[model samples]
Target: MASLLPFQDLNCFPNPHTAISNATDPINVGPTPSSRTCFPTLVPKLEPLDDLFEPQEQEQALGNIISTPNPENASANACAGIPQGVPMEDHVYSEFNRISQMFWAAFPDNVQQSGDDNVSNSDSRAIVPVPKENTQVSSVVVATRKRSSQRVKELVRVGDIRIEDERHHRAVVRRTRMVYDSLRILTPMEEKKSSDDSAKRKRPRGDTRAAAMLRYRGMWLNRDKRIVGAIPGIHVGDLFLYRMELLVVGLHCQTQAGIDYLPASMSPNKEPIATSVIVSGGYEDDIDDGDVIIYTGHGGQDAKHSKQVAHQKLEGGNLALERSMQYGVEVRVIRGIKHEGSASSSNKVYVYDGLYRIAACWFELGKSGFGVYKYKLLRIDGQEKLGSAILKHARLLRVDPIFSDSTSCFSLDISLNKENTPVRLFNDIDADDGPLHFEYLTRTSFPHFVFHQSGSATGCECVESCTDGCFCALKNGNEFPYNRNGILLRGKPVVFECGPFCRCPPHCQNRVTQKGMKVRLEVFRSRETATGWGVRSLDVIHAGAFICEYTGVVLTTGQAQILTMNGDSMVYPNRFPDRWAEWGDLSQIYPNYMRPSYPSIPPLDFALDVSTMRNVACYIRRSAAPNVFVQFVLYDHNNLMFPHLMLFAMETIPPLRELSLDYGVADDCTGKLLICN
Candidate 1:
């Protein structure tokens, strides 16, 4: 009942049975014909390859065939028909047989023969029916084949994913584990103890007893013995306990320490103690003492020397003496005695002879042909016995019971005789006769109406001495210029005093210049010299002593220039008498006293015109050998616009000596010595 077709008309190759039957003679198959193929009656219409096996069924059949050991069974499984319950179609069977034959032909070496007759024909067919709900079943065969091919290609390329030799990796892992284990081995208590030991090693260790002693200004205090170690670098101005014993420690030169030759074994709690063996010879390259008071001198030089002698060079020692004269360097006078007996019996004693400041030092050739080092020290005032008393008396003299009011006049002492006899006023002198048309300002009062004070209204309220905290003293480095003897310290500037608003008492040490003139001075007319006026001192004036001030009208440069052009001279015009015709011009007589002319005028901001009415300062004559010079000063005021012109003694002047000042001239006025008969 089925249509028959030629063997060439089939869609696939011949069956495996046919191929095995004619093994010797191979039949070459061609393309399928259009006409139907002739075959046995049991054979039905052959269906298409897709109709015979779905994609899912084909994938399963292929997996089973590859896994099966028998070649006949694998071929049968790959070409299996429909599900078990469904009737088999002749066309489906024929198509399956063709495909199996072709698969076996393609891989003939993989095929195997099996002799199992008990295996059912249906069981041999491994194909199963695909579920109707599985819509993606068509792509299953392609996806599986692709995945298999990819796996094969990857294995061929990479060989294996895991590392082949893991010995190095294992070693690294073992070392890391050992490090972690070592870190965790220490306990918290052990770690803390180790840290504490490290801190102990870093801390400094010293004698416990010495560490317990109090330290002040670099000196260690031994409270039990009431003694202090005088380590190096101790300063002169520094203050220490009044009654403590000083143990002088030696420097680079010597290790031996003893007090001047007196007994050092005994303790003295009453008076302050000191040590001998003054250290010397430590000079740095810069030749400066680092601004400290300490300085070194020639070791073998005699301690006793005159005040004027300053410079000396050493025979064999460091050149530390070269810088001893540096200004402001403090000097310590250590007095001691040296012992001559054995070390056990011998004792040295030392004492402090007050403090002194270095004034000068130098190197000079000595009698021994070698250079000797010399230094000159000025005794500090408050430290010396006599100096301290003089300062106390000076402060007492400054107090005024009469002028209790703030605006009251200052006290003035006028004397006629050398014994300092008081007089009310001068007889011949007239205020109108002076060149400047201004009233003279005596020590009695200031010209308060013309110039206003410039500093803060609040004044210092120091009781006796002005400390460093005092407003007036703080402005001037906490130092009062005038000494106990009422003498101004050399090389100091104009100092200010506490103002009326100050709370300090009238007798406060800070009120030196404000107390007015202390020495006796007089203004006199000279008939012999053409310079009609001159000032003289009745009492002896020491060097660096304060003198009277030069007071006049304070005018600006513009105002002064106008007055000069209008024939108003700033200074008194020189008048030479006929008897002094041989002296030529007044400028030649006093060559140092040259005044500014019209052509080359001086550039001064403020000029004090003493031409019309002036003080006794205008009468002070010019001399080649002068003893005083003018200094700029500010009292309780701070107005720098018009500072006061004050005069101070440059050198010592004896009684009845005519006071004079150098006019700063270029020519030598000392050349012509005149003898008055």
Candidate 2:
């Protein structure tokens, strides 16, 4: 036997492979028994994936090997292989497998071990075959059959193994085969970073105002509900009250600047739907922001019934609805609650959904004022069920006496058109069905209540006037926010976000901007220099398109710094992130109200004008050209855009020399030219 141990003792330990100066390199033990003692060497190598042996077992006896099925007698070869200390002509292959034992542990499933063997051709065997699992392959490396030997090189990720070094390719294979009967690749191990260490990294401190204000460095709301632009240099998640109307809550928008923007870059198709709402129960209010028992249609306007109840509850007690006369529908209400501080203290919340087996619990809600909730229409198989649901608990005021106390409601607010939902309304739900489905939304600011009465079918089309500031949205059989201009109550604007006559334009993006309105924007700045040259061009021209807009902002190279999450401070009035640059050409001007910083980088008011009536021609970019005469027009009128004077295009861009306007605006045409071409 190859020496029981490498040293003098009987214990099996490695000889401390001296050749492994760099752990990445494979150790090569020569084909000499005296030099390679089988004293159970430390395992570092793994089996090559493409070996002659079966993926999980040694098909033959201890002394034998496995091979691919031959063209003839496939079944014969399955049992014909030799075994047991049987030294065959393929000794080189046997020796190769012997070397593989030193490094097999790296493979997870290569655990089949061989017992002592004798030099025999055939012997008894114990084998269990297991299907091979594919290696956790790298995205870059694809497997191919031609490179059979190369599989061994991929088996090792030892500290010393240099992936690109081809010298150990053969030895790596020999050692791998000797160790494992099975193998598989693992996913790349990710090095985790501790939160403390991340926090310790140095960063460019946030801005000066960030330290002073503590709250203004980002978008926030004030007490009055208006928006206060961010204060320049604060941390994320900090909440601060802005100019009264709006509050600013820090989000990770700046921190996650480079995050994945597309969420559903991959998905499948959608399914169709039918009617959504199953009108369960409803009641009308007797009082109308007043104290009078009027006719409640649910009770069919009983004067004697109404007067008896109004007199009974005059002292304040309870309004209970437990019988079928109160509501005529079935539902599964998972939650319910009673109205607090009601005129009647004992008003019990009756939930009818659970009384009848219909659908799952989607939502249940009720506030002191208007009770609200939502429901998702579940599609089982391909059928859409209109299960009428009712509020287990709600407290809505209907002016006072009649139906004010028992009103429960909800709305559907979604971008339904984009979702391709089918909605339909029906007269009798049990009758022949149509294609329309009902979708509802809620605009809570309006404070209106919505009732899902037993016979109310919705129209097929979903609501469309949904944009910024609009309260309502519709989706597949469900509703969203309760908007001001949404659902109708007694035929009036819910809360009147925009005055009736001031309705927003159909294509407008905000609730504020409407048709025929000119919003004025103003800025406060101190005057600097009186004037600057307009343009110097190589050729003169008559009036046509004079590049009318002004280029007001210019950045510098040292100032053209790119900001990263680290080493950079945040900006305040946080607008115009796209306009930031180190050094470049001219950029356009935004209003002072739109400026992010308190004191903005100076605006160029200087322009060329000959008449000296203090005529201000907008600043155009600067340049040096021979024939391009840049002229400034003078006007006696106060308006800067109209009633102008002189004209010129003074800047000339030579052949290959690229050009751009350095600073301001162009000359205006006053209709009468002061100088002829």
lDDT of 2 by residue, 196-302 (tens): 55566432211111111112111111111100111112211111111101111111111101110101111000000010111112212221111111111111122
- Leading candidate by TM-score: 1
Across 520-578, the per-residue lDDT of candidate 1 in tens digits comes to 56554455333454666644454556677665666656766787775444531111111
Instruction: State the TM-score for model 1.
Output: 0.31
TM-score of each: 0.31, 0.12
Range of the 10 consecutive residues with the lowest summed lDDT in candidate 2 = 181-190
